[model samples]
Target: MKILLATDGSSHAQAAESLLTSLPVPSDSELCLVAVVEAPTWQSDVASEHAALREELAGYRREVEERLEREVERLKSRFGRVSGVVLSGNVVEQICQLATDRQADLIVAGARGGSKIRRWLLGGTSDRLARHAPCDVLVVRPRDDSAEPARGLKRVLVAIDGSASSRGAVERLASLPLGEECEVIVFQVLAVVRSFRMDIVEQSGDLWEAERRQAHDDLNWAADRLRPVTPHVRTVLHEAEYVADEILTVAEEHRADLIVVGHQGRSRVSQFLLGSVSSAVLRHAESSVWVVRTEDADVS
Candidate 1:
């Protein structure tokens, strides 16, 4: 396996590194520590500050390179091969291009975070990376960058909706080295219609029942498939008008360390859209998230 790990020298990024080391990553996997320094911009009117700005940017670049090297050295024990790179450009685009060039199987990154109100909102960089990256993305959010310690995740929640992308996420997650002690919850949120659909809702009662039964069966099948990864697998079914909100609520109730979701939703189009369930989860959930994509898309 190949992984492109992005860092911005934040406490959250350090937490991400600690989490990766705690996990049972493949022995022969290649790990790359990437630090992107967005090119600095200045206005021509600020000519007096040009020289000072240039010097400041240069010092920042040196600091970033030093940190990258240190991180690479630290991760050497966790992976068979480790390297570091310092790039200057759009952070998301650079990381995505690097993944495509290296054909990475996964990208691990820390969520953009802060204290108070910012805790629930994911930074734009991580969100865009998850949406456009060439491979799977793991967005790690340590409970508290200052108070919380780095540790392996014990419980994971996976949301599935009988979609191809959902199944793909399951398969991809199963390939990871989750210990037998790890607990996995295979969950699904059934959709419910309201308001304008009252007349049609009554007519589709039997159809809804059939769909519920199928969802239950699929949950069982998914749980069985995950038994190899961890015997502590369970299933939960929920009926709700909002899928993403339900997922977040369940994850919090269970205190899941990680939340997994498909790159695309059951409708396919909605997930690809900006406000899809997966996107919503990426933005709001406090837990770390893994977005898995099954099919290849144009990377340019």
Candidate 2:
């Protein structure tokens, strides 16, 4: 496996690095460490007048490169092949392009980065990468100072709908080398959509019951697909108005260390419900999130 890790030397980035140690990767796996230095947008129009600014930018870039080198050296002790690079440009684009160029199987990054305003308006680096990366993206949240680090892939929660993308997420989890002791919980949420008050009082009751049964069956199907990967597989069917909220609630109740979901699921009335749900979970979940992109997705 080839993994690309994007860092900005923040505590969140350090959390991602710490979490990498617990993942079950092949012994010969390679790791690529990357850091991006943002080029200053405010420079004098005249080239001669901007010489000092260019020098300052060069110095900053060198510092970033040295930091990445140190991080790579530290990770080399754990991974067989570790390398580092410093890229200059937009953080999200450069990271994604590097991941594609390296043919990375997975991209690991922190949920939040150095810039607050950009994260507020444009979403964090991890959020954008999860949406656009060619491969699976793991968004690692900073661990609570008082909490203990995970030992291994102990408890995992996966959100599943009947979409091909959701099944793709299941397949990806099944392909991972999670140990026998790993426990996986397959969760599916049934959203109750009501058009009118009369529907809510009359038609909604029967519809809810029917949906519950179908959700149970769907959860079973997802659990079966994951059975070969681990024996401790469980399933949960939840009925809620908000799918993402239910998912996060269950994950917190289960104390899940990782939450896995597809980037998009079946479209309803031409709207992609899973996309919004996945985005919400990515932004708010306390556990690490693994956003799986289907093979049919336009990775470019």
Q: lDDT of all the models against the reference?
A: 0.80, 0.80
lDDT tens digits, residue span 1-300, model 2: 899998777777887888887787777899999888776576468877588777877887777788888898888878989999888888889988998898998999877666321231216567788888888899887557322346677899999877778888998898877878899999998775645576454755776677677778878888888888789999988767778899999999998989999888753223464348888999889888999888864442
TM-score of every candidate: 0.91, 0.87
lDDT of 1: 0.80
RMSD of 1: 3.4
Q: Which tens-of-lDDT digit does each residue in 68-111 have in candidate 1?
A: 88888888878999999988777788999999999999899888
Off by over 4 Å in 1: 113-121, 145-150, 267-274, 296-300
Ten residues in sequence with the least summed lDDT for candidate 2:
115-124
Instruction: Give the best candidate by lDDT.
Output: 1
Give the candidate number with the greatest TM-score.
1
Candidate 1 matches the true fold with a TM-score of: 0.91
